[model samples]
Target: MSNADTILVTGGLGYIGSHVVLELMEEGHSVVVFDNGSNASRDVIDSVSRLAAGKGRVDLFEGDITEPAQMDKVFQEYSAISTVIHCAGLKSVAESEREPDLYRAVNVTGTSHLLSAMERAGVKHFIFSSSATVYGNSAILPMLETAPLSPQSQYGKNKVEIEKNLHAWQKKNGGIVVVLRYFNPIGAHKSGLLGDRPKKEAANLLPAILETVSGKRPELTIYGGYNTPDGTGIRDYIHVVDLARGHLQALKYEPDNDGVYIFNLGLGKGYSTQQVVDAFIQETGLTIKQRRGQRREGDVDACYADNTRALQQLNWKPEYQLNDMLSHAWLSHKSSLM
Candidate 1:
């Protein structure tokens, strides 16, 4: 695709999607951000604008993917759009367990609506925001793209269902479809202008740690008694910025044949919860109150990634290390307090 191509980013105001939008704009592509004003701040665009610095054009649209008419209207309005980076979805695993049907409607049925709209608009390129949760709590140490999918949570199930639909959709309609199975995305933009919204209750690890250090939470619970070296669950944490760049690489990738292309976005290593907490304290010299809690049911001992395919195929590699991720995240979280 040329730099002139208009790229539509669903959930573009979101944490990860906002970073992807910044990356695309910095690369000089016109961006049309479609979001429903759910779980996002409109002021995020101001930060994106400051970072983009007139590299490309950006337009924001308020619409829900679950609404077919809204999806169709965006496609029809932006008739010149050639590709889509879908990042909108309800992502809380605990919440999904409570509302499985809600997850299905937004993550599954909503994606179907978007696909139909794309079909009508004649758009052929798509980049989906998938998660490593699709692999479930496998005993496998490092997960690969071809691993058997056994999603345990409703969120993971939603991603697996979407992947299956994308495969079938590609076979029948013929399109360049890329599925990115993200392991664990953490961190924020270097400028501290963009990051996860400061919430008293955070679902992810990094945010929880940041919140505790910033005194938002009383103490960070370190779920323990896992079958790992540190007795804590280990995960593959990739910087959000790195994950955003991976999408840009996906946009440039050309498939060898007519099938869905899937890749894992991760740091290709594991870090225990205790290790992450220690890293945060060491990197930022901040105190994080902590407590020990029993491991959550269905929790895996270790989960990382086998990023060889992403490295060899997309020519993509992560630049930040664990320290960089922690430092940048702290900077962003600290800036939010000001």
Candidate 2:
């Protein structure tokens, strides 16, 4: 956390990465945002800069993580980069199922390249943006950090493989590696300037809800046939702001020694699809035309998190509840329209 050392954030222009960049800047750490610009906009750099407000400097380096030379060049150019917060990867569940090879190449191999480049550049600390999909549909009530991984989708498999790679890399190189496995992340910055604006297809539930509310989609589809009370899938939806703050906490965490520390970033509570839709309608005072749809492949009936590890270890607790998440998301969505 030295003021002189810059934190390199991969995929810094993406939804989660951009928020993490903001948190880092607000913490008085200069950031080097390295993004491919494939699924992100150059405009995010400007928005982040404005939001940072003279706290810490922000710089963007456009490069593909799959390109070893480009990664090496960025690391070489920014010799002061001491830590890398990795958020780059293809993240669509349906898309991953269709293009498993593509997902593996980018999420797995691209990360391998990034790690090699970091090793070459002598950068030690690392923080990974992992997902709850790694846990799959475990029979356990609340998914624990120690639960056996049984990924249901190629996207989840990619995360599991990446986590393995991270552990191996840390064991070999010996450095601080924090893997933050996020559950269902929703909501947006209160200012409404920065939020999830996917360049490609929208896969997440909240985005689909937003689109339905705005008439971009005809109606919301609730995947049914689950064992929950409403027979709809349940997930632990955490606010994007709180998720970003968890990254900041990870960056600030001082470990006894270098090792791979795993923590689930979630609200530790489950909310069914029907409950979410109902809450959205309640919060926004908007009508959402919706229908029941068959459950998609790789989907679990109910999956939430046992976030006690994160709460005790990182001192990170979700500040926003379901109502706050829905309302803030609605506000950001409306502001985007304006």
Candidate 3:
């Protein structure tokens, strides 16, 4: 995609999407934001606009992705849109478990609507925001692109299902679709102008840690304490900005390599929960209370990313480390509290 090409980012006002929008504008690409405002706020658009220095307008459409007519309207207005970074969907695993129907409707059916709309509009270059949850509990320490698919939750199953549908679409139409299987994404934009603002309580570890530091919660609950060296859950936490850059790389991907090309976006290292808590406490010097608890249902003992495919194909590697992730997150959280 060229700097002049208009990129339509679905859910562009959300955590990752907002950052991706900022990155795209920094690269001189015009961005049109398509969000339903279901889980995002309008304040993000104002922040994005201010950050971009008004170089680009965050044209937003407030409508559900499941509505074909709404998506069609977006395509109609922005006919020159050659690329789409699909970041829109219901993402909570617990919520998906509670409402499998809602997950299916938004994730699976919503993706179908976007792809169908793209096909009708003759826009092919697609970047799908997938998750590492598709790997479930893998025996492989660091998951690879070829790892077996075993989703533990409805959210994971929904991502897998959408990936399959995208592959099918690519087969019929000669379109380049890059499915980015992201590991646990943490941290905020370095600017702190944009970050995750979950409508309800957060399920992610970093947010929970921030909440503990902010004193919103009484104590941090260490879910598991009998696994591996740390006796806590380990995850490959990639910075949100790095994950956003990976999407830009995916969009520029060529079409000769058609079908769904999967890349694991991560740092190739895992951090245990206790390790993360220690890092946050050490970095911020905050007295974060903690409690050990039994492992939650469907929680994995450990998981990280091989990340070789992304390095080789996209020439992308995480520039930040665990300390950097913690520090940045602490800074953002502290700023918000102030």
Question: Candidate 2's residue-wise lDDT over 19-107, tens digit each?
Answer: 99998988888899999988878888888889889888789999999999999999878889999999999999989999999999999
The per-residue C-alpha lDDT of model 3 at residue 213 equals 72
Which residue runs does candidate 3 get wrong by more than 4 Å? 1-4
Q: Model 1 reaches what TM-score against the true structure?
A: 0.96
RMSDs, each prediction? 1.8, 1.5, 2.0
TM agreement with the true structure for every prediction? 0.96, 0.98, 0.95
How well does model 3 score by local distance difference test? 0.86
Best by TM-score: 2
> lDDT at 11 for candidate 3?
91
Best by lDDT: 2
Stretches > 4 Å off in candidate 1: 1-4, 198-200
Model 1, residue 88: C-alpha shift (Å):
0.5
Candidate 3, position 67, lDDT: 98
lDDT score for residue 42 of model 2? 85
Residues 150-258, candidate 1, lDDT per residue (tens digit)? 8878888899999999998888789899999998888899999999873225778888887787677789999999888889988999999999999999999987775
Note the Cα lDDT for every prediction shown.
0.89, 0.92, 0.86
